[model samples]
Target chain A: MDAVAAEWWKLRSVRSTYWTLSAAAAVFVFVLLLAFQMAHIWDGLSVERRADFTLRPLQELGGWAAALCLAVLGVLSVTSEYRSGMIRTTLTVVPRRGRVLAAKAAVVGTVALVAGEAVSIGSFLGTRLVVGDRPFPDQGASIAHDLPDFAIVGASVAVFALLGMSLGVLLRSTAGALVSVVFLWHVLPLLVFQLPEPWNERVGSVMPGALPGQIAGRSADSSIYGDLLPPGAAAAVMLAYALVPLMLAGFALSRRDA
Target chain B: MCGGPSRTTVDRMIEVRELTKRYGATTAVDRLSFTVRPGTVTGFLGPNGAGKTTSMRILLGLDAATSGEALVNGGGYAALRRPMREVGALLDAGAVHGGRRAFDHLGWLARSNGIGARRVAEVLEQVGLAGVARKRVGGFSLGMRQRLGIAAALLGDPGVLMFDEPVNGLDPDGVRWIRELMRSLAADGRTVLVSSHLMTEMELTADRLIIIGRGRLIADTSVRELADRFRRGVLVRTPRPAALTAVLAAAGGSVESMPGGALTVTGMDVAVIGDRAAARGIPLYEVTPHSASLEEAYMELTAGSTEFGAVAS
Candidate 1:
């Protein structure tokens, strides 16, 4: 508990934490403007063309963009310590390396989770309010019905945060860990999308961005992701994305000298 | 500044025994052993790359030893639940995040050891950093960072303290402040181990010295012992050199004639030589006791052990 408090104090004391979270929150404003623009364009489109326009992408944009921001937050939390050589002081104070990493993961993970939920749900609601009564093809679902999916989307942000911290601990370099995170968050999914048929959908089904929809039991027909896995399997994979990397990071931290 | 009494009854000692550390093929610390006791400042002296930092790192559990034990208070540092309360260390003053405020930097460290925030402010005031407590460390000079580091070390009021090259970039006033602080800490019955490459610094600050070279212990003795070990004889000058030499020799002092009609007399102190000369009615010009300086003694001890020696032109 002391370690957790210390880690929380350390995270909150730094300016980078606020900077990254504010960047994550900026996605909300961007989504609202995009929603306003989409509503403006919806009025000009003929009824037939209106059936094709969907707000799903703008709704998911908040959580997706925040994943990158919060992940950067996660990366800096550990890598900054390494870069400044403060890791030795940290280890000296709390010699149980596992506890230190766990405390850090706990603190970073919780902040990302809360921010993720806010941005994800906030974007969804804000966009819906702006495009009120438009009744687009994909807007038929009630707020209560789509709320679970947005919640899962928020949870995915925490997963990305843990993954970023793990990479930071393993690489101990901000640039290296951020490159790896960006690869996982944006680049690899795009590359996976280009793979040959059944394989493309099969691999895309497990991508971090794709997991939220799958876990929420939503069909991925209009999206780049696939809907192959059952909800349980998708949820398990999401948990693995957060846990597996953290376990590896813990192992590496304990075995290596600070 | 002294705080409350230490929480533990454990004898405050830093014992490193047969400790060895290796980085791939390079040996950093090799079977090194030393014990630091309370109530005195023990200077961990070594030339650069002589494994002084490496040994301290292993002791602090920041690095693992290849084989051996570095016990603090008769146990491994890792086993201490609140290590900061038992052993405070300032390994590198620059190992701080530039973005953190001076108060917050020490604040988090204090929180880690379950120390109260009041102690943080007290230590900041003790180290004379209270005015800049809210300032970002990025704008601080090297000396300020050093004082901040010392404040962090004092936060928990630990029984044992270790500092590495703490005076590297300090002004003369800061140097004197650290010297007095170290002496006062030792006087308070706390074990203090200060590492430095300068024998002159240690000569004034350290009661006992542990000199290492090439990751090996060169000399583990007190300042007085080291000075006595390197003592040269007394030098005497007189117009009647032959008379003085005969008088000193009669008094069982071995006298050698110097080039300028002077004599180097061993086995007798200046007082004995002066008395013998006065007894013989021989006028004495000068009688001075000579001993090797601690800096020269340190150089001779670590002559070939310097890792990055340059070839003479």
Candidate 2:
């Protein structure tokens, strides 16, 4: 518990944490602007053209952008220690390497989860306000009905944050961890999307980015994701994304010399 | 000296038994064993790559030993809950995040061991960094960083403290400050282990010396004992050198003639030599016992064990 408090203090004392969260909040602003543009375009369009317009992508954009920002936050939480050679001091004070990593994971994970929910839910409401009562194709569901999916979207940000921290622990280099995170977060999904036929959908269903929507029982037909798994299996996969890497990282941290 | 309550009910000792660490084929620490007890400063001296840092790392539980135990207070460091409360260490002064303020750097460390925020301010003030408490550490000089590291070590008021090259980048005043601080910590009944390659620095700061070369213990003795082991006899200067030399030789003392009417007398005490000169009615100019410097003794002890030696031109 003391270790957790120390890790929390470490996370908040740095300027990078505020900078990354600000970047995540910037996504909320961008989503609102895009909503205004969408509303303007909707006003000028005929009813036939307006039937095709949807705000679902813009609503999901805030969470997606936040995932990247919080992931960087998670990466910096561990990698910054490694970069400054402060890991030795940390290990010296705590002595238990596993507990140190667990403490950091707990702190970074909570921050990411909170930031994720705020941005995702804020984007949904902000876009709704800007495009009030427009009745887009995907806006048919009531706000209460759509809230759970954004919550799941927010949860996915925590998963990405944990994955980023795991990569930081394993790689121990900011550039290397950030690059690996980007590859897993963005590049791997795009590459899997290009695969042929059944394999593309089969592999895409398990990708980190796709599991959130799948777990929320949303259709992935228009997106670059696959909708093969049921919500239960998708939730299990999302949990795996957050846990498996952390376990591997913990094992590595315990066995390797600091 | 910020010696809070005495937490010395424990053994208050650092022990290494047959401790060996190997990096692939290279053995960083080879069957090394030593013990540092409280109430004295023990200098851990060695050349570069002689495993001083590696051994310290093992003792601190930052590195795993291949086969041996480095125990503090009769247990492994990793097993200690709230280790900082029992053991404090400053391995590398520069191993701090530049983004953190001086206060926050110590703040998080103090928090790790359940120490209070007030202790952080106290330590910063103790290390003379109170003015820079709110300043970022990135802009600190190397001397300030050393002070910050010391403040962190002293945060928990641990009974056992270890410092690796603590005065590396300090100016003359900073160097003297560290020397005095180390002595005071030891005087406060703390087990202080300070590592350095410079024999002069250790000679001034340490009471006991554990000299290692190539990861092997070469000499483990007190500073006075080492100086005595390398004693160079006594130098006797007199106006009648021939008369004094004969009298010393006759009195079972070997005398070697030196430049300009001086005699190097061995196998005889300064008191005996002075008495012999008086008995012979020979006036003596000077009679002084001489011992080799600790620097020379360290060089001779670690002569061939240096891992990186340049050939003489």
Candidate 3:
């Protein structure tokens, strides 16, 4: 419990946390502006032209900006200690290395979950207010509805943050961890589609990088996702990505020298 | 609470027995064994790459030992219910994030041991960092960083303390301050172990010394004893050195003529040599016992054990 408090204090004491969160808010506002503009011009558009308006405000704002910033947040929690040599001090104080990792994961995971939910709910409500009481086509989903999907978006952000922390422990270098996270999330999604037949579809459904879209109800064409899992099952798969690596990291940390 | 002082008494000692650490084929610390008892400052002396850091790491449970035990207060470091209350260490002062304030840097460490935040403020003042308590550590000079590290170490007010070359980048005043701090900590009955590669630094601060070379123990004795062991012949300066040399050699003392009309007389004491020279009617300018400095003694003791001394071709 003392270790948890220490991790909490450590996470908030640095400027990078505030900077990254600010950047996340800035990106969320950009997405909000685009959603508000689309709601204002809904009357002038035709049925075929309106099909292109597929922005799920909750996912678009929280998924892209929050995932990227929270990844940095989680990765820096461990990597910064390694880079500064504070890991020696930390391990000396809390010699059970697994406890150290657990505290960090809890803190970063909580912060990511809370911040993600805030921005995603904010984006959803802002769009709801803009498109208020309008008799529109089927494209505009009511903000008062779809609460479960919004919760999934927030949970996905937390999972991504945990994944980043696990990578930080495995790699133990800031540049290497961040690069691996970016490659796994951004680059792997684009390349997975090139595989042939059932293999692509089978791999795509479980890909953690693409699960954010699934959580947001923006599942890509059947060719990209193959056969999409239900939202709850998709969340569990996304969670496995964070949990499996976290277990490996725990085993390695206790055995390896700092 | 800031000025309150309590000298707690506890069995604060470090014991390492047959401790060996090997990376693949090369052994970093080879069968090393030693004890650091309370109420004295034990200087852990070794050259660079001599496994001092590795041994300390293993002792603190930062690294696992290949064999043997390193126990503090009768148990492993990780097993202590309140480790910060039992041991405090300043291994690397620079291992702090520069973006953090001095207060927060010590605050987290204090929190880890269930120490109160008031103690954090007390330690900040104790290390003379109260002025820069709100400043970022990144902008601090190396001296300030060392002080902050020391503050963190003292946060829990542990019974046992260890510092690895705590004087590395300190100025002259800072050096004096640390020497005093080590002595005071020991005076309070705490087991203080400080490691340094420079024998001169250890000579001024340590009450007992444990010298190692090439990951092996060379000597575990006091500073005074080491200097005495390395003390050689008596240096005698005289007019007509040939007469003194003959008298000294005739008196069963081996004498070697030096360049400045002096003789290095061995196998005899200064009193006996002075009397022999006086009996011979030889005029003596000076007679002085040649005792080795800590630096010279350290060199002579570890000469064979130095891992990377420059080879003169």
**Candidate 2, residues A175-239: lDDT per residue as tens digits?**
99999999988899999999999989999999988988988898999988899999999999999
Reference contacts recovered by each candidate, as fractions?
0.84, 0.85, 0.82
Residue range with the least summed lDDT across 10 consecutive positions in model 3 chain A: A53-62
| Lowest lDDT block of 10, candidate 2 chain B | B1-10
What's the C-alpha lDDT at position A154 in model 3?
66
Q: Per-residue lDDT for A134-195 in model 3, tens only? A: 54453265554665566666677778789889999998999999998888777776677777
- What TM value does chain B of candidate 2 have? 0.95
Task: Kindly report which residue stretches of model 1 are placed more than 4 angstroms away from their true locations once superposed.
Answer: B1-10, B309-313
Off by over 4 Å in 2: B1-10, B309-313
Error of 1 at B118 (Å): 1.0
Write one digit per residue (lDDT tens) for candidate 1, span B34-53: 99998999999989989999
Deviation in angstroms for B85 in model 1? 0.6
From the highest DockQ down, the ranking of the candidates is: 1, 2, 3
Residue A117, candidate 2: Cα error in Å is 0.7
Model 2 C-alpha lDDT per residue in residues B86-177, reported as the tens digit of each score:
88899998898898899889989999999999999898888999999999999999999999999999988888999999999899999999
| Residue B19, model 2: Cα distance from true site in angstroms | 0.8
